[model samples]
Target: MAPSELRPVRRRLDAHEPEPEDAEDIEEYPDDGFDGRVRLDPGRRGMVALVGVGVAAVVLAGWFVWRDHPVSQPVPALPVVVTTSEAAEPAVAADLVVSVVGAIARPGLVTVPPGSRIADVLLAGGGALPGTDLLGLNLAQKVSDGDQIVVGAPAPPMSSAGASNAGTSGGGGSGGGDADDSTGKTLSLNDATESDLDALPGVGPVTASSIVAWRDANGPFTSVDQLGEVDGIGPARLEKLRDLVAP
Candidate 1:
């Protein structure tokens, strides 16, 4: 055969030859600027965007719920107010009125305690005048209501010659000793004056007056023990005066 005819025959034979056994399979790809990237469909892209939006909306809703329901704080308690009631005070006891007359700066009626003694009345009367015979009166004795005290001049001291005469002439002696009969023997309760009765133990001026008043009302006491019949003079008091008084 000719060379030209051989070239056309070789071309036909090469075209009919089989491919290599070790050749790699190539996948078809489209060119859109990004290489080695997979392209998604429009519907698939829309599904992914919807899922992202739904997750974001869920996170936003959780944040709003947490904001609306915040943790609570404890409240403080209020202070209490106290109220008090006003009341009036009670009345007190009144003072006792007594008439005080003697040798003093201001001798008249004076208010004193219920159990004022003679010394207290003397002080309330601006004290005794100079040279007033204080020993003649019972300074330790308690005074009563409307009592009149006379402050007399002291008796002149008896001379030793006159003291012997006083012993010889008994009736000629002064009668001032009669007021102090308690210094001697038993006193007669039926004849005793209120001042003499005041010398008895536990027998104040008030009780002495009550005794004289009882004797006047009920006659003379029959027995010395009958002194217990008087008010404020109980068995204990009568027992004290048993050796000191006579019916």
Candidate 2:
């Protein structure tokens, strides 16, 4: 065979070539039987579940404590009620019994309250008779309980000669008219007649006669205090007699 006509002969390999590995096939390796991965067994899984349940129970307990234990609030106190009553009034005293005498139309015991005046007693005795002497008498004077009020008769009109004679004898002396006029001589218990004595407070005809008899039996009184020694003369009576008499 000519060299030009000879064909290229094929070469034969002694060993077989390895197949190429793809990137996806290399990453998809199966799990090794002896790897360090953690595994939860039945007991370990139960422990984890119990821890979760314990945490839930703690949260529920805390919520219950918060709901039950609220902030403290102060309670308001109630007001008290008070009731008041009115006071009672005091009672008034009773009236007193007194007698009026002198020149009054009617003279007798009269009912009067305490602190009554002489004018009140005189009014009770039907007022003074016409032309009775009211000089020197303090009609505004207050009278005590059981007091005696007396009115006096008017003096007779005097002539000049008679007045001169009277002035010379008993009219001008210390125990005479001038003295009597100055010291309430219109009501004289010593020299007065029964009618005049009867004209005194609390003195009737009988009491006037008794006073005259007593005066006749006794001596002239030295002081007005001696009037209390007479019968029916008490503190109340003495108080009335004090104004009408002189020592």
Candidate 3:
């Protein structure tokens, strides 16, 4: 065909136009004002938002229920008051009275509480008197009701001359010009006074006084066997005086 006579004819077709393979393979993105652009479907985003709101509502409801519920624990009990018509009474103490005599400065009855000792009784009696013998008494001993405490007088001092005279006269078996002589009467083992019995064998002023003291304490003796009752009189000493006394 000659160039001048060749012509192209245009006609509209009913079928859709086929896309180019190269153009279909190429992707075109819209410009967004961000470095990374992402697209999501509106329906899918709405479903995700609804799920998040439902989860939040459920969490809030659980929190509210937890805050409103009462905790499981034991309740505190109220204090109880005990009232008695008859009140408890105090205990009564025992009353004790003691008498103090002999060698105490004030020799008389003393009123004291129960469970008091003899020392307390002594203190209650104005303490001990001068020259009182405290050796024979137990001051710490407990005192009961109606107890009597007697403190003795202190013994007198002994002189050398008196001691020598006592020893010489008290030594048995000596009939010389010593106190034991023929003219001297045999001393009574129980009731003889010191001056009356000074001449007896093995009998001194102290021993004679001790004999009288025994008589005063135990009453008159019926036999010489009771002579042993005197202080410082042993069996050997009594044997020596066996023939010297009568009933």
Candidate 4:
């Protein structure tokens, strides 16, 4: 080889730069980070984007429908009640017992109902004797068991019509006639008829008939207290008739 035509040899650099003489044969391109072999067509890319949008729209529409209309829950039921039917018991009546003494007939222990007053006890033990003075006695007081009752003694017999001749009726027992209110004379309970008794202040026809019925059933009146047994004759009525009639 001629010395002029022979070229000097050059060492390869660490950067691996091509030799100046070989640079003309090497092809150059832009610095963009894209592989030419992996490129996609514009039509294929547009179709893929459209498919993804359609799937997202369907998912969003399904979520909205589920939020608007929810599932319905079941309703609770009510409770029932029950009752019982039973019979009631009956009440019983009670009685009282007490001892009685004094001017009353058949003085002894007697049985009476509860809430019996002193007058009731007296009536239970027969009527008091005639002319018996009952002063300062509580005839309306209630009584209980095991009590002693003391009746008032008979007062001395006196005459309302003074200086009048005594008319003896039967066996030393003086019997006065019917009432003569105009003459201030009292009526005799033993002999007075219903009509005679009905003429009094408070005694009506019914009371008069009851008095007669009582006399007929129980014999003659022994004392004014026996009038308490007659119908329609309360303590006030008996008090009104006390001075109007004599037993």
Candidate 5:
């Protein structure tokens, strides 16, 4: 074998020298003098770790407290007030004054409620005498104030003085007064019926009813002249009736 092809002989190492290695076997390494990051000592590192652990524990405790209960704003209260009021009173209707007479239990002046009827007047007069016929009376007719209600019997006859005020001829009206008892022909203004007044010259049924209504409203006539107060009885009409009637 050629000398060049022979294996390189390895030298034995001495105690004072370093061992030699082949160039191909030696490895290239990067420079490693020191790192850019700051390093701490064992004691300092331990203190930093302890401080971090303490900070984390404190943060965790704060999170737990905040999750359980939160802060809230307070609200203000308002005041209440009370009030009182008075009630009003009701109104009452006025009563009417009327005269109830004739065959009733009690015949006299009586006060009744307004818009009362003839039946009410009968009740006010202690009602008509027992068995008294009511078929002749208009119990449903409305009565006014100062009205005279006669029940169960005829009206009383008029006296001479009252007849004189009538200015009427007797049962046989001759348009003038007659002094003789047999044919004196005296007509009582108070007792005279509507037919009697209608018989007077120039007096009609309308005028006669007006007279009766006026009498019913004003009571028995004090004088024949008072008839002038009736409605539709103007000064001219009154003059015509004045001679036809006395009073």
Candidate 6:
């Protein structure tokens, strides 16, 4: 063979021989920490940043969902009441006891209601006798729990003609009814009846009735001067009867 043909064959053989690795493909770097982790290249760091951004977006989406849909809470309750009732008692009234005597039909102790009047007590004792005097008493007045009603007994009724005859005739005459009956006898002021009072010279039946009414309303006259208190009996009439009557 010629020298030119041998040179061509040697060049072809050199072209087939293996070349050295690139610096980027396989690199030797110092350890960044004691754990032996190597520092990453720029391309690897970029890929890690992309992964972190994706995780942050996922966390933000979860937070927005939690804010929109809130959790629920509980409530409370109320209370109650009750009541009861009972019956009440009733009230009672008391009675009044009183004593009655003197000229009443039946004189004794009697019972009446709490607010009874003197008239009621008198009626309970069987009412006043026919000749009993009521002029000195106030029958309409209310009575106390313990009371004694003594109805005064007036002198028996006398005829107007007999009273006048007794007043005009003198004593120690044959026709005189009895030795005790006298012409100049003074009449009793406290016990005289209407007919006995009419025997007075100036006193008529009307005046006698007025005197009895006055004694009933205001009680018995304490003195002869009190006779003037009657409706028709004046000072002159009182003087005329003053010497003839005695209380």
> Considering every candidate listed, which one attains the maximal TM-score?
2
- Residue 242 lDDT in candidate 6: 82
- Give every collision pair in model 1: none
Question: What are the per-residue Cα lDDT tens digits for candidate 3 across 124-176?
Answer: 99998887668856677676665556566333223333344555774554623
**Lowest lDDT 10-residue stretch of candidate 2:** 7-16
Candidate 4 regions with alpha-carbon error over 4 angstroms: 1-184
Query: Per-candidate RMSD vs. true structure?
Result: 13.4, 14.0, 16.6, 17.1, 15.2, 16.6
Question: What is the Cα-based lDDT of residue 205 in candidate 6?
Answer: 58
- Across 1-247, the per-residue lDDT of candidate 2 in tens digits comes to 7655443321223233457788777876477764757665759889999999999999999999999997899988988867658666678888867667667888878888877887888887789999887884678987666456667833323323334445565533565755444443335567666776666655556566776777888877667787766664557657755766554
| C-alpha lDDT of residue 85 in model 3 | 88
Query: Candidate 6 lDDT (Cα, whole model)?
Result: 0.69
In model 2, which runs have C-alpha deviations exceeding 4 angstroms? 1-86, 153-247
> Where does model 5 exceed 4 Å of error?
1-91, 155-247
- In order of listing, the candidates' clash counts read 0, 1, 0, 0, 7, 0
lDDT order of candidates, top first:
6, 4, 2, 1, 5, 3
- TM-score against truth, every candidate: 0.32, 0.38, 0.30, 0.28, 0.32, 0.30
Give residue 36's error in model 6 in angstroms: 25
Model 5 lDDT vs. the true structure?
0.65
TM-score of 6: 0.30
Worst lDDT 10-window in candidate 4: 154-163
- The digit string of per-residue lDDT tens for model 5 on 179-207 reads 23323243456777887765554344566
Error of 2 at 151 (Å): 1.4
lDDT per residue as tens, model 1, 39-72: 6665988999989999999999999999999799
Q: Per-residue CA lDDT of candidate 6, range 1-247, in tens?
A: 9998899899999999778889888878666575775655659889899889999999999999999997887655655544447555566667876666666888777899977887998899899999777885678867655444556734334443446666655655665664225434566655678877765544555666877887788887678877877766644446656876765
By lDDT, is 1 or 6 better? 6
The deviation in Å at residue 147 for candidate 2 is: 1.4
